[model samples]
Target chain A: MDLLYQIFVDPFVQMGTAPDLLVQTLWEGLVSGVLYALIALGFVLIFKASGVFNFAQGIMVVFAALTLVGLYEKGVPAFLALALTIVVMLGLAVLVERLMLRPLVNQPDIVLFMATFGLTYVLIGLGEIIFGGDPKVMIADQLYLPRGAIDVNMLGGFVSLQKIDIAAAIIASLMVAGLAVVFQKTRIGRALRAVADSHKAALSVGISLEQIWVVVWFAAGIVALATGIMWGARSNVSFALEIVSLKALPVLILGGLTSIPGAIVGGIIIGVGEKLGEFYWGPLLGSGIESWLAYVIALIFLLFRPQGLFGERIIERI
Target chain B: MFYREAGQYKTSYAADQAIFPVLQDRLGLIAILIVAFVVIPLTGNEFLLQAVMIPFLVFTLATIGLNLLTGYTGLLSLGTGAFMGVGAYACYKLATIFPQVNLLVWVVASGFFAAGVGVLFGLPSLRIKGFYLAVATLAAQFFLSWCFIRIPWLYNYNISASIEVPTRTLFGIPVTGPTAAPVTRYLVVLSIVVVMTWLASNLVHGRIGRMWMAVRDMDIAAELIGIKLYRTKLLAFAVSSFYCGVAGAMLAFLWLGAAESESFNINQSFLVLFMVIIGGLGSLTGSFFGALFIWGLPIVLRNAPGAFGLSITAATVEHITFMVVGALIVFFLIVEPNGLARLWQIGKQKLRVWPFPY
Candidate 1:
């Protein structure tokens, strides 16, 4: 009976007793969800433009952050380092399109996916060699990201929110709105959508597949940079951050692989669901259920909606 | 030519159906088996046996397990490391419970536990396909890895949270644990790998293999043809996990001698997947080639600088190895996406048609 209460009722009772903690947890979850959505956004951009899964998005986040920090450490001004990092990401986008995607064109999806895995190793090796293996501070002060927290009184208690987190949430929303504009208003965006719909059809319509690939990859690179800054401000910039960024995979599937809005909604759902499960039900199982809870949630959700919440309905014909 | 199969005649279905129907191929198989069974163990140094050969074989088993699913049945799985962990933990628990049972028996039996877990995870594959299925398997990977760490019972409540292999004997010869001879362990691992590989070969060459291939080529077409997609996929999961389970058991007991949950992390899954891709998909011979290349490349790279009399720091070498391996993978994918097995076939083809281009 006690076990039943613990599993089924105690967490809710606790939530009822301490509503402020629930709100605090939800806020934290929302902030992290926005970050997860950013990473998933990078994935969606590349996957939509090209049919490739692009497993290197997580590493790209780390690499971009590492470059920003590594450049700053070399006596360059913070703004100059940021500009140089953008240039480097642009260079990387061009290199990837020419070297990796171009030659591997028309290969099976799995082959392209594995190629991205190779790209991951290369970036990891390069990042470590250049920046050393140790973690570095994100240079948040120079970047002028806010510090400290705000205490809001509610529900007979006070909820403390990190100012940096609030900034991260704002930045994420602004970037998404900007991306929505670029995607909706630009000629390149039209070409990208056409290419995404059908490679051959897009080519027949005189769309340069190569140009679109480079543009999409560079755009994704910018997203990775923004994500790196937000995520690094929250924690130390390190290769370990790459592993944590894998939280985006569940987010990717939850939002559906091809949907932008899906990614955002999925990220928040996974983030909030993960925090709630970890806070309430974690003790019943163990304290570290946070590691696998998002995946389990996504897995259960996948059972009912295989194409995801926003993915196009899959139709098969012989 | 020496490699010609021109004179070979098959008068019966069994003769035609033989795995090595060509005379040269059969001879090649015998030569390789002799080297594996007799030549290597008898003459190989301890490091060669322990560090290279045993790990190569263990990874080969895991690669084969994964290839049977991803390469054969067209189900991409990322939970291979966890399935292998299941086998290791099951073997560890089984050994502790029934101390007198032959350790080898427990190693093979533990595969059943992994298979069950594999099937449970694989249930999602019926509704999910492609990358989605892959992510679902990641759930298995992370969840089982968590279980490995969180459940103290899996490791017998070891203070260090690692499974330490006990000294297990086979026919009065110590085969596992620190005091065991490297050659003894090598021989035991070699036997298990060889037998399991042979069984895998037979499985892939039989009717079941065709079912898996049909599923791989197109599940809908296979379903229309009356091959139950669910049963085929689940069987692939069960059998693949069984192979991975045995490989994990051997990896822990025969190779590493002790292991923590870290040994079976997602990186291990990626490493095996790389081997499968680099070696060749859906080919048994490719599994060996893939294992050897992926596992052997680092050792070769690490030793190359010393051989060339170049002085470099160990850290530099490690980083360079990563870059080189990554570059080589891309280069190989670009040069021949079909994998090294295809290259091997091409080499044999060139030899057969020497002095003339086909």
Candidate 2:
């Protein structure tokens, strides 16, 4: 009985009168949603260019963040460390394309997908081996991001928002907008779309697919870094965070694998949904309901529209 | 040459139909079995036995499970870890409820629970395919993981919510828990693996296996040809989950001896999937060989540097191992999409045509 009260009833009772707690919960959800979308965007970029699911996006987040912090700890300036990290990411993109992706080209999608599984291990081993296994604090202050909270008066109560949360939302929006422009307007973007559509057609038209794959993978690495820093600022940087990346799989399902805007919308929905569930109705389930909430929502969406929010309905032909 | 198989012809179909057709392979397998059962138990170090061999045997079972679904049946799954947790939890629940039953029986029976869960989740496969199906399995992963943690009965109301293995004797020989001898535990696992892997191979080569292949090659055509996509896919899920579940139960009982909700997370699923891919999809031999290679490398690297008197940090060894494995995956993919199994096949083809151009 006491377990029920502590696990379920008390949390709900607390929520009924706690407007401030509601606002705090909403803010945290928004921050996490943006981070999830950023990671999804990494997945979306590679999927958009290569039509491969790019399972390595999660560890790329860990790898990029680990590299940045490890570089800084080794006496590189924060900004310099950031630049060096980009170079390393670019190097990795080239190495992957040259070493793995090129060989995997024209293979069955499953084989390529499995290759990413191998890549995941390589990155985990590489990341942990190069950077120590211990979780490190984000270089937030050195990166000039605000760490304080802002007081807000709303809904008949006072609420607090972390300045870092606000920065994360803004940065994610800007990055998404930048990608939207590059993919929709640029010539390289057109070629990537063409290749994503039909590799044979794209090749016959003189498009260099190898270049597009490398460029897109490198772009994913950058998004991964952005996600890493934002998420790391909220918690800590460690391989443990790799598991949370699986949550983005549901986000991809909700938003559609190939849509940039879909990732943002899906992120917000999951973020808000998880927060609301945990705050308002979590007590009903004895708390910790947020873990599967996004999946349940995605499941409902899949039943109705397997094509996703913005994706095209797949048509089979012989 | 020692490798030649001349004058070793089988006198009957039964002899030819033996598990290993080639005499040399038969001999090699016997040598390995002897090493595993006798040599390693007495001579191998703790790290070799515990870290490499035990995990290898367990994960080899797991890789076979995933390979049956993804590699053989042509279904991609992201929920393997959750199925494993179900197996582990089912064993926990069953043992708690029926304390009088033999421990091994409960562990084996736990797989049925996972098979049930797998079939339920697999219902989506009838309506969906490819990436959509993969995403659908994600639901199973999240839902099952959440259940393990939220349900108090799984952990017996422990504050930490972890399942601890209980001590038990099988035929008066300890097989699980702290007091069990390593050799006894290993032998139990080895026997189970041997039996289950044989069953999997038999199933894969039989009527059901061909039906699965027909469906994988072309589902609509297979349906037109009377292969029930619904039943076949669900059976794949059931069998695959059963294998994974048994491995998970054994993992919790015989290896870790204790586990939390986080014990069988999504990462473990991906790792198992990697083993199947790198091994050789559709080949049981590839399962053991791939598991040994991928799982064994770290141990070999950790030990080799010391043997050579070269001072190397564990981190450096780990990183180098990553680069090597990464390179090997690409090498195998480019050179042989069939994986290490294909390489082995090509070598055999060359041997059959030795010293001849035509």
Best by TM-score: 1
Tell me the alpha-carbon RMSD of every candidate.
Answer: 0.9, 3.5
lDDT of 1 by residue, B29-122 (tens): 9999899989998899999998899999999999999999999999999999999999999999999899899999999999999999999999
DockQ each: 0.85, 0.48
True contacts kept of each: 0.74, 0.56
User: How high is the lDDT of residue B277 in model 1?
Assistant: 95
Candidate 1 DockQ category? high
Whole-model lDDT values for every prediction: 0.93, 0.85
For model 1 the local lDDT of residue B80 reads: 95
lDDT string, candidate 2, B230-249, tens digits? 99999999999999999999
Which window of ten consecutive residues has the lowest lDDT sum in model 1 chain B? B1-10
